[model samples]
Target: MAYNPSPKSKAILDQAWDWIQSVEYQVTVRWVFYRLLQDGIYSEKKGYRHLLSLTSKARKGFYADWRPWTLADDTRAPVLVQRQGFYGLHLRGHGFQDEDDWLARIKEEINCPLDRWASQPIYSEIWFEAAAMQGQFLHYANENMPLLAFRGDISIPEKWRSAERLAERYQDLGAPIHIYYFGDYDPKGLLIPASAWRDILAWTIVILNSKGLTKLEALESLNFHR
Candidate 1:
């Protein structure tokens, strides 16, 4: 059934809709509600009932179709850059249209690599893990760390590429890989670490076995710390 928002609810929805149209990226319901409150749409309405009503209406196409804002299956997103004016990008090995010049640019300009493989070599035994804490893991909040660190979710398959790389590096270094982990003590929190370690173990085993290395037990020196 469609949500029939009241006139006041529609007014709130319209205001949020206007803000959504003005931005290029997706905006959350709470974000819209704050803007509406800031604009004095509702005088000091602390509750979320009206906001919920508007969102319900939106989801049902009563206000606006919510698919664009909510239908993302992959966690990866495009990297964005902000600047005051236009920025030009081309693969000439040169900055502009020059017939003879190839791949040469001013010294001050930052060069963009043509290769897709961007990860560099590492020589560290230390690794960090955040059990389902995406904010700390994938630099979701831009928490910077070395290449050996990573974040894991309920299913570790998504992080398998990283796990495989880490295992390869550890094997080459002939050192035990130590994972320093951060996880909540709650129900879901406690389980993520164990599950993550299981996948990591599986990934490492596959990499080692493929390499035809001996001392499988000695080579796979992986451990997780709280």
Candidate 2:
């Protein structure tokens, strides 16, 4: 029989799920690990330690395998799709707000001495903005890449229509397209994008971070054209 998560493990996983749903912090595997550690859900010597070890063991196979998660599946196959705006808000040490003050602060901060590094290769190419006039930070590429936004309950037909339009536009341009997403880290948040865009395996999909090379390696191992 396959091993199931022990009660303790399940508790830790539950807390991790709660944290992601809260969207109080930027979601990443590392953050998820850290949050679990903080909530006393896992200990440094036992549970958290073991989980980290498992991550290392699973990393190679996880990246190599593109198995979709099913409700009836025995194991959880969570995809970590890193989004852009999440990092921006985290960097600014705040969450979304609907005020010109926030944008002004961002502009000022970006131009500040401490933030001179923002103009470097990393930040220069990324566009940061507040959407819907709300404080919800939106991170996107400066390259005019196509994008489609959908909530969880949205119909597949609408999703496909957006994807078809995006694909056609990119094909017309003859330029490689990349799909970038930034959202809370959770089963639903990660799986949604993976499931929606799994067919676009030929295109590059990158997570934004210093660990980008690791993601690249994972994609390459999966035989993605990136």
Candidate 3:
């Protein structure tokens, strides 16, 4: 059955919808609730719950002209596709005249690639404790370096995945991996990088054992900095 919001609820939904549309980056429902709270629209826990309920209803097509894509939860998104824009159009003032022209240009661009970090001594990545701040970091981060948001203490699976990537890259490129972590100065923040590094090293050791590298040797190339 379709949900029908009350007149008051509809007004709130309208505001939330407008706010969501105004932002360029995708936002989680929790983030949206907090943002609304900061605007003095919501005060207590009950209000937060109400916003969640209304967001669910709006995304489910309970309201007219509201689509599911309007509110995206990146954490639960099954498949993510990168939207690659053509900046060349801005410079040339005319995009490809036809489909064939576009394809030809794409093929040429793919074949002739510019290696930005080829001469760099080390591979670097920036990690954030708050996932929502990723968009801010992405705005300034270099295209070559990855920006990861741990959301808190990094998970075991994520640590293992990072370890695998680091190990593989270290072995292939013979270069070091430097991680620059950003977080608060609280107790958890102070210890999270160390804890995450330890786990990653443990996983790396296991993975690199087959290559006849010891724990100390593997640790040499994986540098973690705050």
Candidate 4:
């Protein structure tokens, strides 16, 4: 069914669009809902469904000829495998003479930059509780630095893998790991990092010990802060 917004909803959408543009970043619908509540443009705690419908319609161009993806939901996006031959076709279209020219261009294109943190004494990462902010965080994050979003409380296996990665990095560079965490200041958000810190430390010690390192050595090798 097609969505037809009431005049009040249309005004709300215009306000939402203005706010979204002001931020200069794609935000989630939940973010928009909360913003409306904070701005007094909306009330009624259970009215989220109505707001979501209006936003969806606006994004799909059911109201005005609006841009499609004004609101973002990175988690729900489809993943697709990249096509390699497109590079060759693009080069040819750009007046490349032969395969040698295409091959040279492709080689340079595929040659990624040197490691950004090889000589640094600290292996740094950015962590957040909401996956929706991944794109925004990545916009300013340094190359080769890990970015992790827990999307709520992180799982045991995920923490184990994180520890393994940190252990491997410590073995390679002997650097202390630093995590610059970004999340809500709520009680649950505060607890997430605290729990993760304790668990990751224990997991890192276990991983390093299996490689014939002592507990004291493991403790010395692994360093992390939230």
In terms of TM-score, how similar is model 4 to the real structure?
0.51
Q: What tens-digit string does per-residue lDDT give for candidate 2 at 78-130?
A: 54443455334243344547678777767767732343322333211111111
For candidate 1, give the lDDT of residue 57.
42
Q: Between which residue pairs do clashes occur in model 2?
A: 83-181, 83-182, 96-135, 97-135
Candidate 3 per-residue lDDT over residues 9-121, each given as its tens digit:
88888878778778898666777787778887888757877887687666543377564455655365333343347533233334568999878878877655665656789
Q: What is the lDDT of residue 82 in candidate 1?
A: 29
| Candidate 2 wrongly placed segments (more than 4 Å) | 1-147, 199-226
Off by over 4 Å in 1: 1-73, 79-156, 218-220
Give all TM-scores, in the order shown. Answer: 0.42, 0.28, 0.52, 0.51
Residue lDDT tens for model 4, 1-226: 2457788988999877777777866687778788888898878767777887787656443356543346665344343333346443242224556989868877778754676778997778888889998998889887577899988876544666788888887777777777788888889889998877677787677778888878898787665555
Those runs of model 4 whose alpha carbons end farther than 4 Å from true positions after fitting are: 1-79, 82-108
Error of 1 at 79 (Å): 6.1
lDDT of 1 at 199: 55
**Ranked candidates, highest TM-score first:** 3, 4, 1, 2
Compose the digit string of candidate 1's lDDT tens values, residues 1-226: 3456778777777777788677877666666777777898756666456675566446434245452133221344444432333345543343445733433444356567442222424233334445245434456422334434344443233345546766676665655656666656778766776766665666566667777755456344666676
Worst 10 residues of 3 by lDDT: 86-95
Instruction: Extract clashing residue pairs from model 1.
Output: 93-103, 93-104
